[model samples]
Target: MARRATVYQVAERAGVSIATVSYTFRQPQRVRPETRELVLQAARALGYVPSGNARGLAKGRSQVLGLYAFDMFLPCDLSAPEVGLDDLVAQELDRLGDVRRFPLYVDEIQRGFELEARRLGRSVMLGSGTSRDSLGSIDLAGSVDGLAIFPGGAARDLLEHVGRGVPVVIFSSPPMHDPLHHITVANESAVRELVDHLVEQHGHRSLAFLGELAAPDIGARFTGFQGALAAHGLPVPEEPFDSTVLTEDSLRTLRAAIASGDVPDALVCATDQLALTVVDLLARHGLRVPEDVAVTGFDGIIAGRLSDPTLTTVRQPFVSMGRLAVRILTDTARGLAHPTSYVLPTRLVIGRSCGCS
Candidate 1:
């Protein structure tokens, strides 16, 4: 093989000090973009190769990020079965080990991360958000220069403290405090779109919404559902069924309401799981889905596809959300100024359940 080029040669070709060259490749988050570009150009021209040993010695640190994601692993564990648990856990662990691993999940986002990491010559270490008590001792203490946190966990306070020490980006909705970055979907608008599709296209006027109404995101969804009804000039029915759970008691209550001849023409669930449960309950009551009462749900989960009369839903760009979180965190790591909240786009996925086009 040809003689390997040295960092000294690369620095000389780039017309920058050895420190700048090292920061450009090793600790890129600490260097300016223009300087990084110059160093990369010099390396390419001089046929210089990056040596891990040289990079570590120059930067005084490893080029890796501390990433935390509770979203994927949480839902997967809840939805997937015990038999497949081992495989799912392995896949999750693999996600953490992958060098380009931060919080990025979508395809385009992954591509962007790969490009940035290559240009910066850095790697990432993925970690799950701690279960509150173990938050501090969970290796986020100074192992990495940056952090990416998913929503719906007790580590918020811990992350807040970590944010003070390093750049932190939270991938969640309902915007957090300033200086901390967040990436989330347009939850309300997407729910409105689904509700409108049901009412206008599918002829559903009387409707009921089921799910945890206490959640901020879910509350927004309910507002959207009600707003759609008002916009359509549809009267809000008296005592629309509000269900906390899809257990036998709640399902029986719905069945009784239907039997009493005051059933909602449509039922919009807060999640795919709730939607599936409602569908099963309605069937048990001799109500044919869509033919008797239409249904739609939020969160385009895989289970929705398999449910009878495949569920119509609002697709909450989970993958994109993951990727956006990664981008924001990396940006913060590099000392770039970004907003506290970034609302991404969401879309409606029509299915047989909605009885619409």
Candidate 2:
């Protein structure tokens, strides 16, 4: 293999110091236009590419930002249809296979992040983590100037550890006692509107929230659920159903609820995925949505839009949130003033599932 060209050779060919060549790439505004052009021409002639690692070492900051998500890019398993999948579920699977892609809420946010980062002349380093391993597995601390994390599956200790040295912006999670920056949606307000719509418009007296308490966003939504009930003088339920994503366990729980005749008037799921699954499971149990049991969900994912009855949900400003996260990270990295926390607005979308015509 031939030797790769270096900045030293470019600087020699341009009759300029290495610092001038560095500024030509890293900070062209600081270098004269004529000098910058000379350096560029020399670099082009030598076929030299500036080393990002070396530039970061010299500048004490990488020009790239890190975005860490939990299982955001995990490939969908389309090998075979699982047994007992309803027609709707199978149709969704077929659509995903036809497109050869399925994107989660995190992927939408990532698009916004990437667009804004590119506009600001920075790049993003995408990373993924899982519950079984810490975010340290990605090893992004020294590589990026700052990090934006969707701290759901990540450990709090690990987040704090990473934030100690890097400016960390936690998105889509509840507020933390630590001083780390946060960017979340208006979970309380959106849930209040959703629940209020159910009670005031649909005359739903008894309602149940389905979500896992372990997740911070779900906890926030649950708090909002209670607040809405109190505001309307409705009795607060004892606890939300302990559930995560849609799974066989969740289906079993729904079946049991139906069999025992303990179903609520309306079930407010913390996520669209759960609500969609609940709708399918309820249908399998001979229960009609809205007519028998009203259902609503948070996070206006695309799957919700394609549901049979369509999902009643809170549409979070994910694209705006992603752009804001990148702006915050870049501003903080540059020692500029930035809010420690930002809560964006959300809109309540009434669909057929929420008993809306």
**Highest lDDT among the candidates is held by which one?**
2
List residue ranges in candidate 2 displaced over 4 A: 1-5, 8-47, 71-101, 135-138
lDDT of 2: 0.83
Clashing pairs in 1: none
lDDT of 2 by residue, 1-357 (tens): 778899899999999999999999999999999999999999999889998889899889889999887644423353345666588677776676332134568878989999999999998998876745674524886689889988776777888888888888888776668867898988988899999899999999988888877777888999999999999998887677545554445555556789998899999999887787789888988899989999998888887887879889999888888899899989988899887888888999989998899
RMSD (Cα, Å) of model 1: 9.2
TM-score of each: 0.65, 0.83
lDDT of each: 0.68, 0.83
Off by over 4 Å in 1: 1-62, 69-124, 129-138, 153-156, 235-262
Clashing pairs in 2: none
